[model samples]
Structure formats: C-alpha cells, structure tokens
Target chain A: MTILASLLKRDLGRFLPGTSSGGTMLPLLFFLAVAMLYPFAVGPNPTLLAATGGGVIWVAALLAAILPLDRLLASDVHEGFFDQWALRGISEEVVVAVRLLAHWLSFGPFIMLAALPASALVGIDGETLRIVELGLLAGTPGLAAIGIIIAAITVGLRSGGAALSGLLVIPLAVPLLIFGAGALSTGGDGGLALTAAISLLLVAIAPFAGGAAIRAAREG
Target chain B: MEPFRLAARDIACRRGDRLLFARLSLALEAGQALQVSGANGIGKSSLIRILAGLARPFDGTVERAGTIGLLDERPALDNDQPLGKALSFWTALDREAAPLEQLGIASLLDVPVRYLSTGQRKRAALARLIGQQADIWLLDEPLNGLDVDAVKLCEELVAQHCAGGGIAVIASHQRFDLPGMSTLSLAEYAL
Candidate 1:
C-alpha cells in the first residue's frame, strides 16, 4: 500500500497540471478552444447548436485526450524510470496501473468541469448538459486507457510517435465516442451504461497490455 | 552485508540479426567485482543487461540471489525537477538517505536536472544507486563523462561497495581501478 501511495504521489506530481514537472493546461485549453470555435464555425443557430453541440463536446473530449498521450509513457520509458522501477521489483503492470489512474485524474475531472462552460457555449439544454456530464464521467476513463496503451506501444518510435499515437487512439476510441455521444441523441440510460462497461473493460486491460508493450520496447 | 550471488551460464546475446557475443559465463559472490571491457558495439552493455535480467540472452540462463541495481546511460532522474526533489523521489522509495555530500552533489540540489552537466548528472545517478543499497550493481559506462576527481570517487565508491559485501559488474571501455577485479574482454567471446 505504501508502495502504491508513493508511486501514485510521484505520478500525480509529474502529471497534474501546475506541478513542478511542467504538466500543462494544453489539453484543457484545447478542449475549450474546440467548444468556443464550434459556435463560430456554425454561425450560432440555437436549435442547430443544441442539436449538434453534444457530439462536438464528445469529439473535443476525445481530441483533448490525445494532447497528453505523447508524454504519458514515452518520457518515463526513454529516461530509464521503468528500468529502475523494474530493478526494484516494481512490476511494469503496477507502474502502468498507477500511470493510468494518474492519467485519468489529470484530465478527467477537469474536463468534466470544463464541459459546463462548453455546454453553455454550444447552447446545449440543461437536461442534455446533465447527460453530457454523466457521459464524460463514464467515457473519459476509457479515453485514458486507450491513451496509455497507445503511448506504451509507441514509446519506442521516437520522433513521429506522438502524431502516430493520436491516430491510433482515434480508431480504438470510436466505441466510447459512439456510446457516450450516442446517449445524448437517444436520450437513454442504456448508452451510458454501455459506455461505462466499455470503459471498465478498457481500464482493466490497459495495465496488462501497456506493461507488456513497454517490456517489449525495453527488450527491443 | 547479506549473502548475494550473480551468475550467468553459457549465455549468448544476439542483438537484431547479429550475434554480439556467445559462449560467455561468469559468476560473482558477495564482496566480488568484475569489469567487462570491449570496443564500442562489442556487446558489453548487452552482457550487463543479460546479467541484470533486463534482457534475455538468446541462449543459456542467468541466476541471481539479491536485488539488482542498474545505472546506464540514462540517469533516470526527472529532467524538469530540481536535483534534490528528483533524487528525493527515489530516496523516498528506497527509504535510504543518500550521502549527497560524499557524492559531491549536495550543493547541486537546487539545480534542475536538465541544466546539470554530464559529470554532475553522473554523480547524481551515483547517489541514487548508493541509496538503493541493492546487493548487486550493474553499471554501464560509469565513468564516461567524469573528471579526474569524480573518476577516482567512482572507483572508490565501487571498491567500498564490494568491501561491504556488495557485488559490482561494470561494463566500460575506460580503465576502472579496482584491486582484484577481474576484467572480461567481450572481443574474446565475439563471433
């Protein structure tokens, strides 16, 4: 438990925005920029904004998840933190699990908060805004999971890996986007429940998959 | 001071398609040290990795009886952090206070690690290694960027570690002065 706590502390300190490790507000800023720009692009028709705004938020959230992907595992793997942790008998799986949690915590709640103003900008109804908040809560964990997995797999690719990771995540994250955004249109609990289930599955598999990916990167 | 052992049996390492070395083996008991030397690209680092259990040999096996600590090219300290805070992360985990003054890095604690020179970073890494207090130390090119005094300090540190019943396997092309330390030239095992 102490080990986990210490690891969590280190990971959070490195990842949380405004920490000494240079964790940026880039993702949050990008997310809001998307919401802010959508109205101008579509000329601010209230009915049109209300109808399509939810999907725009979903797309923005997904894109925001990509902003931090490059830094997630690459720096740690390249800089030998993983090697030292391995030497100490801290399994890659444990580190990846802690990292996944940190990754989620860094962007998840903040994006949920950002969504409030985003909903206002996009002219979403109160009931729809509530669903968007709930959907983000259910869907962002899966986004974080997908981000970590791609980051670990691409950790060895050096220069172009960041762009490639973003591309890789889009395809993998289609399900979460569909279900989470699909809930807003269908006005149903079933979509949110399915989104949460998918998130749970991805979260469960991310640590093992990411652990193996990094170990392979190390040996290769 | 606990009993520790590191041994490799008929281990062969293949990087990509080429075999770097083959039919190599060595063993170290407590209070022993070995230095692996070779030309660049001759597999000294691979052999250290094999022994450290970080990479698998193409053939044969490695056996160990203690915690392993590795210091390679990467210092592993967080680049954006002050040296003190960066080192503290590990000291906190290892639960052992490093002798920063002895490593000549006590005064460098406030410097962010990215601004540190090669020698300072090397010394900081050494502090982390000493704090780890692992039974076996696998060092790859420990003296690459050190000055005369730092080089001598590194040699003395390794000697003290061995004298205290710890094991050290150093992979370096440069001279490493440690009495009674056997040298293994990887060229002899190169295929």
Candidate 2:
C-alpha cells in the first residue's frame, strides 16, 4: 500500500512539471487543436470524419505519452534511484508498474480530452462515442505498460529512437488502433464490445512485456 | 535474526562489453561495514549495483541483508517534487531530516531540485539517507561534493547505522575516515 502511494506520488512529481515546461505545451495543445480541426483540415465529411477520429485521437494520445517516456527512468538512472530501489528489496517490476500507472494517469485523461470533442465534431453517435471511451478505458493502461519499457530502453539513447521506437511499437500497437477504431466505428450491437474484450486480453500482455523490458534494460 | 542474507558466489558485472568485476565475494554481520575500494573503472560502482540487485552479476554471488539502501554517485531526486515529497519516496528516510533542512536547502524545499547546485544536490541526498533508517547502507562515492560539515553529518549517520547493528558497504577511492570500518578491495573480485 505504501509502495503504491509512493510510486504514484513519485511519478506524478516527475511528470507534472512538463505540463508547464518550456515549449512542450505547444505540441500537446496543437495535438488537441488538430484533433478538433481534423474534419476541417480534411473537409467536413461526417462519415469520413467519424471513421478517422477515433484512430486519430488515440494515436495522438499514444504520441503525447511518448513525451514523458524518456524521463521514466532517465533521471533515476542518472541519480541511482533504480539501484536504491533495487537495494531496498522493492521489486523493479513493482516500481515499473507504478511508473506506468502514473504515466497512464498523466496521459489517459488527455486522450479523453482529445477524443471527447473530436467525437462530437466527427459526428460519432452517442453509442459509438461510449464505445470509444470504453476502448480507451481498456486501452490506455496498456499504452502505459508499453511506454514504460520502450521509454526505459530508449530514454538514454541518442538519434534514431523516434524511428526505432515507432517501428518497434507501431506493429504491436496496430492491433490496438484497429480495435480501438473498430469499436468507435461500430454504431450499434457494438462490434466494439468484441474489440473492447480483445483489448482486455492484449492489455494483459503489456505489463509482462513492459516489466521484462524494464528489468532487462536496468540489469543489462 | 539479523535479516539473514545469502548471495550466489561470484559477483560478475559486464557493461557495454567491458567487464567491471568478476567473482567478488564479501559478507557482513550486523553492525559491520565494508568499503568497496578500487581504482576508477575497476567496477566499484558496478559492484554496488550488483549488490543492490539493480545490475546482474556476470559471475559470482551477492548475499543481501534486509532493506539495503544503495546510494548512487548522484542522488536520485525528482527535481520537480517538493523537498519533502522527494525525500519521502525513498521510504528509508526519517521525516525529521526535512528534505530541505538537512541539506540546508530548506528555503528551496518548495522549489524544484533542478535549480540546486552540485553541492546542494549531494547534501539533499545525504539528508535522505539520514531519513531512511534501513538495515544496510550501500553508498557509491558518498563523499563527493560534500562540504566538511556535511561529510561529518554523513559519517555520523554511518556510525549510527553500524552502532545500531545495521550494515554498510561503501565504495569510494577516498578515505571516509571511520576507524575499524574495513575495505573490501575489488582488485581480487575482478576477472
């Protein structure tokens, strides 16, 4: 219990400052604005708009999360937090989980903010919007898991990470985007219900993969 | 009862294709301390990491006791956090140390740690060690950047930990000046 609280506090403490950090707010604000402007940017075609909004918003969310990934263990790596954490017998897996949870909190809501109004603009019906939210609910935590490891390994690397990380994660994430968008595309009888269910299944793999990746990076 | 500990024989560490240490062995009873001393690049820090379990030993074993505190060369601090909160995260520190006070950064406690100088950063970490009353202290070059007074405070803490029957393993090229505290040379531990 204390671990969980400390983990949450630590992550937020590290991540929240970026909300006000120099020049970062612009990209996220632009992301939010771009989500709002998609129909306008691509033309106000409702069917096309709704069809793409879910994917666009979720993708932006995944990207926004990337901004903080480099810092996940970067500071700790520099300062020896990871070593101390390990020495204390607090499992790295637990610390990694906590970091991801905090990442989820940091990124999850912005996803909703990006999608909520975009749904209205894209003309997604209430039901489909609900499914979009449901998919996000099931999905964003998975993003944190994926982010935890990818960020840890790549945080300290120089150059080519954008491409490397994208290549590595996109293939894995394509499924998520597919189902996530599919759920929002399903208007009634919710083909999305199945998508959402599959999301749960996929999300389970994230923590394990994330845990292993983080451990390997730290130990390796 | 003294938090019985066991490590596999040989503490091996190889990073970026360079082997830091191999087949290092050491043990400590409660109230003991061992300073892991070696020439730079010989893997004293790496040995500390392996002992702390943050790095895998490429060769031998690392027996560990209860709730070890591994101090890194740089103090792990979240600069964005308030002085109190960052210190609290370690769970080994006592609140009385007051994240900012022990480090003489009390005025800056509410401010970001990123703004502090090198010496201030070291002092802040020292305060945290005072706060965390753990069973073992594994410090890496702990005296770096500390002023004389701060060093005294740190020495006092180490003395306190050992006298309390806790254990400490410090890695440094310089002398820490505590009488009877032994040095575990990594020269033999290296491959």
Candidate 3:
C-alpha cells in the first residue's frame, strides 16, 4: 500500500546510513573496532582468535544493534509522530511494523557485509566465516526486533534510557546469541535453522509488543 | 470536508495518582469551535488529547465522526532535515501540498528545522496541519511561540477553517479571538 511505502521511505531516510540521526555507519564502525581490537588484546594468538572470533562477532553485532536503539522510536514518540499517526487512523502496530523492517534494513545487511573484513581481522577461518555470515543472516532480524521492543519500552524514560535499553537487549538477545554462535562451533545447518526460527518468532511478535509499548508510553 | 462531530461525556482524566479533572463533557457539531482555557496543569492539553482520541479518558468515552488533526508543543518535523524536506514527508502522506507561503515558511524552507526559531517551527507545524485538512482540529497551545502577526494569521486560518464547516477544539490559556467561538473554563470541572 502507498501508506506503508511512504512510512518505509520516511523511516529509511531517517535511519539510513549517512543521515544525522540514522547512526550513519556508527554500528558498522563499532563492530569493526571491536573486531580490530580483539587481536591486539589477545596478543595475536591465531588459534585462540580463531576459536573465539565467531562468538566475538556475535557479541559485537549484538552491541552494534543496540547503538541505534536510542534513536529508533524515542525521537518520533517525543515529537508526537505516533500521536499524529494515531489521529489519522493509522494503528501503532502498523507504524512499529514498518519501523522494525526499517531498523533491520538500516543495520542488518551492513553488519553482514562488514563481517567479511571483521572475520579477517579476527582471524576466523573460511569455514568459520561462512558459518558466521550465515548465522548472522539468521540472527540479525531477531536482534533488530529486540532493539525495537526495548526502544519502545524505554522511550518514555528521560534519563539513562539509552543505557537501560542496551542493558535490556543483552538478556533478551541471549537466545539468538546462543543459537547463532553455536552454529560456528557445531558447523551445522541445524543451528542456523534454529537461529532463523527464533528470528522469525521475534519478528512476528515485535510489532505487537512494540505497538503496545508505544501506547503505554503515551499514557505514562 | 465531510460532516464532522466530536462529543465527550462525563470525561475524567487522571495522571498518575492525581485526578486532574472530573465530570467534564462537551459536544461540537460541524462549523463550531471551542476554546479550552485553564491555568497550567489544569488538564487543558489533556482535554484536547482526550477529544483527539490520542489519550484515554480515565472514565468516559469520546465519539468522533471525522478525521482528526492535532497540533501540540512538538512540531513532529525531523529536526535534522531541511524544512522543505520535513514538510514534504507529511505532504506526501496527506496527498496535499502544504500552504507554505501562507504560513510564512516559504522563505525558510531550506533551513534545518533545528535551526528554526520557535515561531518558525510553529508555523511549519501549522502548514502540516493545513495539509492534513482533517475535519476536526485539536490544537493545544497553538499560539505559544507565534509573533503578533503569526498569531493573527493563525486566528484567521482557524476562522476560515470553521467557516468551511470544519470543527476546531483549541486548548490554551492565551485568549484566542474568533467570532462565535465558545469558551470552556476547565477550572469549573477541576477536582
């Protein structure tokens, strides 16, 4: 529908790379920074690096997902965008759903692209790199979902919300982390499927949860 | 442009543990305007929001028969974007061009919204509201940051809107002059 398209276009503009509030490659850069620092901290131990690099990438991706949470829904809610939408007979669910897709598009693919060089920096092998990429592909949607749900919940908080959202995402993201990073160790497609399944579930539920959170925030 | 109506009955608003007001009621038919006036924290904005259906009344129901437009403290414009681009977003959604020149924001369209003065931002919000062209307008403190000329322009716009058979409910402590505009002092219903 045209409504959804317009909403997506606006969201992409606000959140896409290189925009002022959009995080503009900060998450990707942060992921690379984490990857680039691991080798130095571990003193160039190839075996140790290879063994832990995939997990490190997963952790970094999780953190990177949180980087944009503060901007995800807070600014719109604060500026009364949600209220305006509500008045127009547009449901919060639709807005949050569009936002979830936009949030994923803004960071998910870029993080996946950055993982190649990140693998090189962290000394992950070709086999591990393939699994890491695939696992991330399966997991990032869930990460984006977690970020949005938490962002909605924390949008009404004045102080410490960014930090609080980050903290809240960690525990909720553990399932994705376990399944995604587990794929690296197991070297099997089964873990990837499970990660994808979890991602699907999270994606399915994010819109409703986020929608309720936004409404509750308005009430508060 | 469709026939519009807004009605609230026995509406009560509670914020946190405190009751702001109780047993408030009003009705607006087409071509009618109401100004909600009260001191700060007297639920003027809350009353406007309750009528707009953005917030739930603690103990009543609101019935509305047309599309609603709300203007509040926030302009709902992207602060980082140029004013033209920001208004374009709403214009695209509303499928109508904003009256930028009429709102006196045509010259400042290239400026980032963050760099705009409060009055400029308010005018931009007015443009957005105009573009929406909703049948019912819920304006909360719409005169807060406008200059003398802008305030008069705002009154004229509202008057024109009401003359066109649209309904407007304005909530502000500042006196808003309009012919045949009914005023509601919220203090009467304060608990």
Candidate 4:
C-alpha cells in the first residue's frame, strides 16, 4: 500500500547509514572496531585467533546491534509521529513491522559485508568466514526484532534508557548468539537451522509486542 | 465533510494516584467547535487524548464517527530534515494539499525544522493538520508560542475547518475566540 511505502521510505531515510538521523555507520564502525582490536588485545596467535574469532564476531555483532536501539523507536514516540500514524488508521503493528524491515536493511547486509574484512582482522579461516556470514544473515533479523521491541519498551524512560536497552538486549540475544556462533565450532547445519528458526520466531513476535509497548507508552 | 460526531459519556481521568477529573462529558456534531480550558495540570490534555482515542479513560466511554487528527505540543516532524521534506513526507501519505502559503510558512520550507522558531513550528503543525483532512481535529494548546497575528490565523483556520463541516476540539488555557464555539472549563469537572 502507498501508506506502508511512504512509512518505509521515511524510516529507511532515517535509519540508512550516512543519511542523518544519527548515521547508522556508528554501529558498523563499532562492529569493525571490535574485530580490528581483538588480534592486538590477545596477541597475534593465529590459531588462538582462529579458534576464538567466530565467537568474538558474534559477540561484536550483538553489541553493534545494540548501538542503534536507542534511536529506533524513542524519537518517533517522543516526536508524536506514532500518534499521527495511529490517527491515520495505521496500526502500530504495521509501523513496527515496517520499521523492523528498515532497521534490518540499514545494518544487516552491511554487517554481513563487513564480516569479510572483520574475518581477516580476527584471523578466521575461509570456511569459518562463510559460516559467519551465513550465521549473521540468519541472526541479524532476530537482532533487529529484539532491538525494536526493546526500543519500544524503553521509549518512555528519559535518561539511562540507552544503557538499559543495551543491557536488556544482551540477555534476549543470548539464544541467537549461541546458535549463530555454535555453528562455527560444531561445523553443522543444525545450529544454523536453529538460529534461523529463532530468528523467524522473534521476527514474527516483534511487531505485536512492540506495538503494544508503544501504545502503553502513550498512556504514560 | 461527512456527518461526524464525538461524544464522551461521564469520562473520568486519573493520573498516577490523583484523580484529575471525573464525571466529565460532552458531545459535538458536525460543524461544531469546543474549547477545553482549565488551570495547568487540570487534565485538559488528558481529555483531548481520550477523545482522540490515544489514551483510555479511567471510567466511561468515548464514541465517535469519522477519522481524528491531533495537534499537540510536538510538531511530529523530523527535526533533522528541512521543513519542506518533512512536510512532504506527510503530503505524500495524506495525499492532501496543505495551505502552506496561507499559514505564512511557504517561504520557510527550506529551513530545517529544528531551526524554525516556535511560532513557525506551530504553523507547520497546522499545515500538517490541514493535510490530514480528518473530520475531527483535537488541538492541545494550539496557540502556544504564537504572535497575535498567528493566533488570529489559527483561530481562522479552525473556524474555516468547522465551517466546512469538520469538528474542532481545542484544549488550551489561552483565549481562543471563535464564533459559535462553546467552551468547557475543566475545573468544573476536577476533583
């Protein structure tokens, strides 16, 4: 529908890297910074790096996802954009769903691409790199979903909200991080499938949970 | 322009442990305007939200027919974007042309929303309300941060909207003079 398209266009413009609304590049840069820093922090033990690089990448990806959570839903609720959309008969679920897509588009693919250079920085093998990319592809949607839900819940909190959202994400993201990184060590399709399944379930539940959170925020 | 109605039945509103107002009720048919006035913190804004269906009343029910539009203290525009782009975002969605020139903000389109003065932001919000073309308009403190001329312009805009068969419910402590518009003092309903 035109309304959905308009909302998506606005959300993407706000969220896409390098185009205002707090430039999503910060998260991408933070992700690569972690990868770039790991080798030096632990010394250049290629086997040690390779052995632990996959888990490091997963952890970095999870933290990087948190960087944008503060901006995701708070501004809209504060600025009354959500109320306006609701007036137009656009349900909060639809807006949250569109925002979920835009959030993923803004960082998910870029993170996957950045994983190439990150893999090199962390001393990961070619096969491990492929699995890492695949795992991120399967898991970042779950991350985005969790990000939106947390953002909605914390939209009402004034200060300490950003920190709280980051802390909250770590616990909820444990499942995705576990299965995604587990695939690298296990060298099995089972972990990837489980990661994708969790991702699918989170993505499905995010819009409704986030929608309710926004409405609750309106009351407070 | 469709036949529209907004009615609240013995609504009670509470914020936290304090009851702001109770046994408040009003009704408006098409082409009518009502102004809600009260001291600060008297729940005028809460009643507007309840009428707009954004917040549930602690008691009673609100029944309405036709779409609702609300203009509050927040402009609802992207702060980082130019005024033109931000308004265009709504224009594209609402598919209604706003009277930007009449609102005295046509020249301000190139300015970023954050740079706009308070009066200009209020004008821009009025433009957005026009673009929405909703049958019911719930304006909370619409005259805040406006000059005398801008205040008159706002009153005229609401007057014209109602003249065109829309409903306007303005919640403001400031004086809003409109011919045929009734005023509700919230203090009467306060506990």
In terms of lDDT, model 3 sits at 0.93
Model 1 chain A — which ten-residue stretch has the worst lDDT? A17-26
Interface RMSD of each: 0.9, 3.4, 1.3, 1.2
Model 3 chain B lowest lDDT segment of ten: B1-10
lDDT (Cα, tens digit) per residue for candidate 1, span B24-118:
98989999999999999999888988888889999999999999999899999999899999999999899999999988999999999999999
- The segments of candidate 2 whose C-alpha lies over 4 angstroms from its true place after superposition are A13-28, A44-67, A123-131, A152-163, A184-190, B1-13, B16-23, B91-108, B188-191
Error of 4 at A107 (Å): 0.8
Check candidate 1 and list the clashing pairs.
none
**Residue-level error in angstroms, candidate 4, position B165:** 1.0
Ranking by TM-score: 1, 4, 3, 2
Pick the winner on TM-score between candidates 2 and 4: 4
A105 in model 3: Cα distance from truth in Å?
1.2
lDDT of 3 by residue, B1-191 (tens): 45689999999999889999999989999999999999999999889888988789999889999999999999999998899999998888899998888888899988999999999999999999999999999999999999999999999999999999999999999989999999999999999
Per-residue lDDT tens digits of candidate 2, residues B1-191?
Answer: 65634344766688888876676667787888888788998988877777776777777667775776666656787766665556666643232444445557677666666777777777777777666666778788998887898888778778878888888888999888776798778887666
TM-score of 1: 0.99
Candidate 4 TM-score to native: 0.98
Give the per-residue lDDT of model 2 (tens digit) for A54-161.
677777766665665555665566566765665556666777767776767666766676677667766766766777787777777666666666766674455665
The window of 10 residues in a row where model 4 chain B has the poorest summed lDDT is B1-10
Q: Which ten residues in a row have the lowest lDDT in candidate 4 chain A?
A: A19-28
Clashing pairs in 4: none
Where in model 4 is the C-alpha error above 4 Å?
Answer: none
**What digit string (tens of lDDT, one per residue) describes model 1 on residues A92-180?**
99999999999999999999999999999999999999999999999999999999999999999989999999999999999999999
